[model samples]
Target: MLILYTYSFAHMFKTSSFLMISSTEIGKYIRNMGMVCFVCSLLLIIFPTCGYAAINTSSTLSIGHTLSSPNDFYELGFFSPNNSRNLYVGIWFKNVDPRVAVWVANRDTPVTTSTANLTLRSNGSLILVDGKQDAIWSAGEAFTSNKCHAELLDTGNFVVIDDVSRTNIWQSFENLGNTMLPQSSVAYDIPGGKNRVLTSWKNDTDPSPGEFTLEITPQVPPQGLIRRGSVPYWRGGPWANTRFSGIPGIDASYVSPFTVVQDVEKGTASFSYSQLRNYKLSYVTLTSEGKMKILWSDGKNWTLHFEAPSSSCDLYGACGPFGLCLRTSTPKCVCLKGFVPKFDDEWKKGNWTSGCVRRTQLSCQANSSTKTYGRDTDVFYRMTNVKTPDLHQLVSFMNDKQCYEGCLGNCSCTAFAYISGIGCLVWNGELVDTVQYLTNGEVLSIRLASSELAGSSRTKIVVGITVSLSIFVILVFAAYMFWRYRAKQKEPTLGVVDTSQDAWKNDFAPREISGINFVEMHTIRTATDDFSSSNKLGQGGFGPVYKGKLPDGKEIAVKRLSSSSGQGTEEFRNEITLISKLQHRNLVKLLGCCVKGEEKLLIYEFLENKSLDVFLFDPTLKFEIDWQMRFNIIQGIARGLLYLHRDSRLRVIHRDLKVSNILLDEKMIPKISDFGLARMFQGTHFQDNTRRVVGTLGYMSPEYAWSGVFSEKSDIYSFGVLLLEIISGEKISRFIYGE
Candidate 1:
């Protein structure tokens, strides 16, 4: 009996220290330590044996009893959801605060009595029975053997297994309850018309299924969808190579990589997330509010990584048929081009569900005798950066031009969009749930009457004529002034420099730039609250930057050029002209520019994390820039420089490349900003000489600073200095001084 007790003690601990001791040695040590040691050893052996991770046919888990996973990562026990007296058998995270339940056995059928028990029956089935001895819930189709047991795994999966074969008969993961753990999938069998969906809880306190159900739609190329009853509340759009076509926010470098497994033979598709980092506990949950959110825990608290239906525009058909939803707009909803509000008064009051109607009817209808049989009178208006409307009919083996012709041939076809991955999608019914995105959206072409097209053409022609006439008058006046000045130059006693409006116009002429808004001064003033001191972010060489909130609630950084600054009109114009045309992810986005009187403001996207200099210089913040983050920042800066040097349409050289110019976004992604000193080169023009060497002292290259010769290599030298500063968490000036 003593030998047996010693062996059991060694088996219970299973540690290297305990395993070192032989049975004979353990018995001898117990005898020498007396009854106290023997009793303690016996208790240690019995304690773990009494509370096992798995329950055999002989064991039962009554109310208040719990089964913890081997590693104690998860626990399975009877739980009462917030404010509820009823009990449910569920599995929850053991280490998490506020106990996050992942799987519930009896979610819909809760036991009212406290005497409920979870037991492994002789038939190898795991059953939950209430105080009345009634089976509340059971694992169906038990194994024939009597040696079956139920186990709670570290993966948060509660499984009923046959001990003899060690095969899992049933698992809690198969019957999902709102949450999708890492590697767990939401599957759909297209052939069977069956799916494993996640339904939202009724409320925060209740575990019962709510109105919202999230599942993968069985389309040709499957996509995720959230449905409220029978209608789609929010769609994940069609599946692209990397992510959902509609969700541009889910990038390739996201923490969780979403993968859809499509089995053509089986006709099954499953959407699952593969976590890049296993140490971090993350889950995709269908919230009570009908929003699907991905959250991760950093050992302390849960942080929301991403959420679907995040905006008012994300709601399906929010803008209705023939309407476009713009989240950045004040009203959020507007009619498509050549369409007017169905109810003007209701639309003004923010009721957009009625949608819009065409301003002019199509003349290509079959009933119209004036319509030509071979020729169509309808013209297609191309709308870019838009989410294609719902109820699209896919037409295969058709190119873009063929799709356009096909749509024009049919009077019933309202609109058509050709996606890269998906074939031509033509819409016959009214276009519904169309959303206009600021970036990364499909192009949609809507058929309009010739009269409507003619109206747009006439407006453009009138505007062109007006602009040409205005320019001609200005040129004629400037010519007369120049002639008078030249005649006066012959008899001049002292030379007078021209600094009038005409001179300013000659120096700072407007260029034909696209994708940039010319913001009004009054609007910017209102947004920045009349340039209040509290709104001021920081002052630079150009001027003070102020944080402004637009009428649409978009935060912007307004870089206002000071009149007293050395770099004024030329620098402002240079920045506006250069950055406006450049497009890159690592480069800062220039939203618009405002030129009113003395105020020359450039609007930029508000980066919450601000410049790298702020973090690198500060002792407390420097810790955030670990080795990995610094490496990523270095790579991003390199990519941005490469684009400026070779990849971009214009071969440009950023004269000023420093830590202060490297801005960091909320995700700590570095974006190179401040193109005030950027110089654009013509084709094959690699180097340029300038008398004025404009740049920070420490960051300026030797060739650029001394000889006034600048090239792409000058930026590379500055980048090398900045890279060292980032890695060492020290400024270039400080490093030089220390050396």
Candidate 2:
């Protein structure tokens, strides 16, 4: 699955393309414009905005009014929380229910009445004021002298940009809310000792700052921490290469990783995740109860995928310092092998916060020089399937043996874990937040006195290691076999095409398709929201048609061939070959296509008014079209049909000509669509015969419906039927075929 992106300004419009219009020229242009443009100009001149993508200083956004993101993905306006009287200016998803606010400007100072105005000042700033003209919140410091305007991006970032320079003077992304929208990330400023943080809303009804917050800590190797005020509520382990040391089991293919980067020159460390399952529109929200959950919208519904501190065992310092938290254990908390509970009574009461103390001190800590690890003075006790402790220093030791000896040499080193991704990790002080998962966790070796290890038999340790390795190998083998079985059972899926992509080989595909642009399946998924139900327009014999907008905001109508349709492959190839050869203003233009295994899509230039049937068949919309409009549509259809039969390079016959196939463009000009069942005539051929009849039931001609013969005359008869339907507003029911 992929996410549709509208984030970068560079891709939208280049600054060099902007034509600077002076005040005098603007006035001249306004006077010369048409009535609609004149009215819009008046609105922009006076109040500037009622509804639009961007707001200049001349614009005033009042209550009940909103400025929507370009694609209408996000809205910025004054809104009151559920059951709350006060109103605050916030940004929320345009389609989401319950009005989930992502950012609030007036959380602390809300207007009681519905007369507040969010005004952009000449100083390149925005101010929210109530009816009394008292400022609620003023923000955005000017960075350049260029005239700036504000816009809400599809990524949910509110930015002030230089209208001419296209420079980003200020942005709301710098000042984050409880939600981390896509393209937004937390960074640690080492020199300033400040970090970008997400503070939760106080409660469901209030946007005032809450007690819980999530921030990236700038420890050499930075880790994420959810804090309750100054105290840590939950730890997101450490940035151990591709994963966190303490929070394991995240598939790199799905759950994204926030990799750390230390800028030596700038003296700052930052971690940002540029990839998610579908990166651009995904988000992570910090809840009121102080939990981070990652989610994404599939157009209609938001799917929650991952959550942190999911269990009590995952909570920060659940078993306190030098304590281990295991989900399977009866009490869930226990002291290490070489340690005992500091407070025995509290431990028995299941209050293990007091943690544990070493039963015997390490030899190095005692003598400072008599360190003989695993042999005499001190020994390392291995704890498998466990999360390494917090605050562990990154050790540069290359191998496990070197990492072990490096830790053994240091009297202060309490434990060490050598992981492939992170290399080596050695904890100096007391260990905290150590968790034991059932599977896929790092192993931590704890340093202890030799006397504590003397009781444990060498055979038991060797047997345990052997059994763990054997079981791991068996599980991996079984998983691989299961995956293979599943893959074999599943129907073939589509992939990016280089040569007959999706195993859909065509003799003409290699050469004929050289002129046709092939889109990636990823791009199609992104544009159509993974072909969600919301994007679907209508179902036809071919399959379903969906409305989608490309990254450049170009709208396209995609007809996806159903996987189970036995005849779809042939029809798909027919449409591709026919439409690609024909080009006309009255005929639907074929943009491109995507072919992957069972998936076949035909992309067309989208008609805004949709097909003529929508206007003809619908009761309310029917009245909207006058006789003049109907006559124009009739003429346009006639012109399209004439071109298809006479003018096209290929003498193509759209065998499925019907009211539904006659699509109406933005200007209400009819353009013929759907060439899946089209036929072509060779030199001196006027008619074609077929055993199979394939077309919409109502649009089939009598001669073609009964017999196998079809020609230009037969299409003309169907056209006459379509014309009768248009003029009389009555459909001819010709159910002559199964299709």
Candidate 3:
């Protein structure tokens, strides 16, 4: 019996170790085995993690427990909403800020306790059940789930599909909530003529539907409108030739790839956003304030990429019908040229809700019987830089010319404008919600009375006839006198003079030149804000340069020649005459010139990157000009010289080519500027001489320095010095004479 007891003790010890069972922990190990198997079978219910077993629909998961993906990129289980003890089945970003919740199975109906068991049934449907064994939420089987599997894609879209066919059964995009992810549409597909829309959240915390809705209208030129409680709040304008006119800022700002799908046959449109870069998180959200905004996240909080209702012009009919709104103006609304405020007193008191009325009443259809007396013909007035009115009709089978002709042939056609990229859009009713943009891209023609047209035409005709008669009489008298005095003259004085003689005869006169559109003094003053101190961008010996944006949204740098400045009006005129005709990629475009009321303003394309000196001189900005950009500057100067000296119609010499004269655009493209001291050469001219030894001291060549001789070669020498300066990042003047 003692030997038998010893054998039993050793055997018990060996068995205990194999089962991982100790005297006190035997119960714990047995219980742990059951729990491990339970977790292994339940892995399919929770987000995938390193510790969880690989599971498919065959495995089931329950609440009071969880499962993770193999790579730990996802986790799935029962979750409770904030402040709500009830549990929910949801999927969220495992590694993200704010822990973005992508999909919610039971949002409205939450399970009361931890008794909710989330299971992937054998039939391939995900089922969430309560402790009472009641199905809380189920992936309803509208179609066969014979081979179905649910996958949480890396793009944050939960897609349920048939495993064998790889056919998607249902997607998260079909039932969008508040946030619109990239490639998702906010507008809805109408089912049985009932639209399904992505409504805004009641607040950031609540995902319930809100009061606002966005949809595309079936108007003439179909447009997108946002409504609040069935009242139009914002209109994205009718689609112009290319895009919606109301969203011009989008075209200018966005660099990302995007597309808008419009189906006329299906009568549906969808805006889609995509990115080649994975890190760019793009999304669109309609705010509680009823503003539609497109946003992007960069691993942190969301940034506003584009937003509508951004300006006063975006407000629906803020200026009323027949009224144009200028945000920069005092009252923001003004009656169109031929119209007056309907209520003058109220309009003056900042109340323009009544809008404007025609100054002259329509008389076209007044007397149909009498086509002469009371039957005043209708006429259309040219309105430039005007935004076309809303509520248009799209007419097919008509080009721009045909569209205009169709409108012109009709007596009732009020206004018309053709968009090349979008086709023809016309409005026949009251013009409403019109606003002038700084970058006005539309040209509208408004109808008027024939009497008004005839009155203006008669005055112009009389003035023209009078001027022509005076010129004709003067020519007749000059011909008679020249013919009588030809015998006494050296050559035939009435005919064309030789090129050499013509140059000498007109040397003293302010030469007449063409191709330059002259901006009036008043217009220049308005652009520069009356030479306001605030508009001053920079100052030099020529004058203080002011930055101004024209009515058409083209930014310009105006060089307002100061009275006491060394460069006089004649020098300014010379520069304008020469530079206007010269066009080169490296040369800054001279838009127009103004010489009136003692105000000489030269309008040039604005360069946002500023001059080379602005970047090259300052230590903080100098690093921006790397080897590549500096090399571009060098090559650009070479190409510009090639054009001016050899390629251009007139052989030109830009006598001044300095760092300050080189302007940089927003893209860092170099533009050789400042033709104030420029000289033009005629014929096959290789060289020319100038009496004035004008130019910066350091840039002057030795030959040009001693002698008052200059040519295209002199300009080349200066360009070489500028090239070295750009490379070394040092000004020649500063290098030569210490400052």
Top candidate by TM-score: 1
Candidate 1, residues 1-739, lDDT tens digits: the string is: 1111122333555688888999999998778769877786677445533333577776777776678877787788888887578788888887788778888888888999869888888887888899999999887776687777778877778888887888988788788989988768899887787789999888876888989999988775677899998899998776654567677454222223677877757989998886634345778889888899888787678878779998888899998789999856453999998999999999999999999998998877645454353155689999866777777777774578899888777777789887655768888869988888876567799988877767677798997899899999989988988987887788747444454433444565455344667788888999999999999999888889999999999999999988676887778878878897776668998999886656678999999999999999998988877887888789888888887998666899999999889899997888899999999998788999999989999889999999999999999999989988888787777634443
Each prediction's Cα lDDT score?
0.80, 0.77, 0.67
- List model 3 lDDT by residue over 1-739, tens digit each: 0000001124435765666656568677678879976785465324333352322465455664444433444455566545456676765545545555445676557787657676665566677789898888876675566756555554555566677888877776666655566666644344336454556655554444677767666564556677787877778776643356555443211232444566666666665456423345566567667787766556677567678777776777877889888745343788876789999999998777689998886664433444442223666776644556787777773565687766655555667876534667777768887777654346677777766666667788997898899899879966875775674466644432222322222333444444456776667777778889998999966899998877787788999889777887557867778886675668888887765545567889899988989998898999988897788778777877877887665788887778898888887778888888888888766666767878888887777888867887788888888888888888776645557
Query: Model 1 — TM-score against the truth?
Result: 0.71
Q: Between 1 and 2, whose TM-score is larger?
A: 1
Q: Estimate each model's TM-score.
A: 0.71, 0.57, 0.56
For lDDT, candidate 2 versus 3, the one ahead is 2
Q: Name the candidate that leads on lDDT.
A: 1
User: Which residue pairs collide, candidate 2?
Assistant: 494-596, 502-597
Cα error, candidate 2, residue 277 (Å)? 2.8
lDDT of 1 at 570: 78
lDDT of 3 at 241: 30
Clashes per candidate, residues 3 or more apart or on different chains? 0, 2, 13
Residue-wise lDDT of candidate 2 within 159-182, one digit each (tens)? 888878888777888888788776
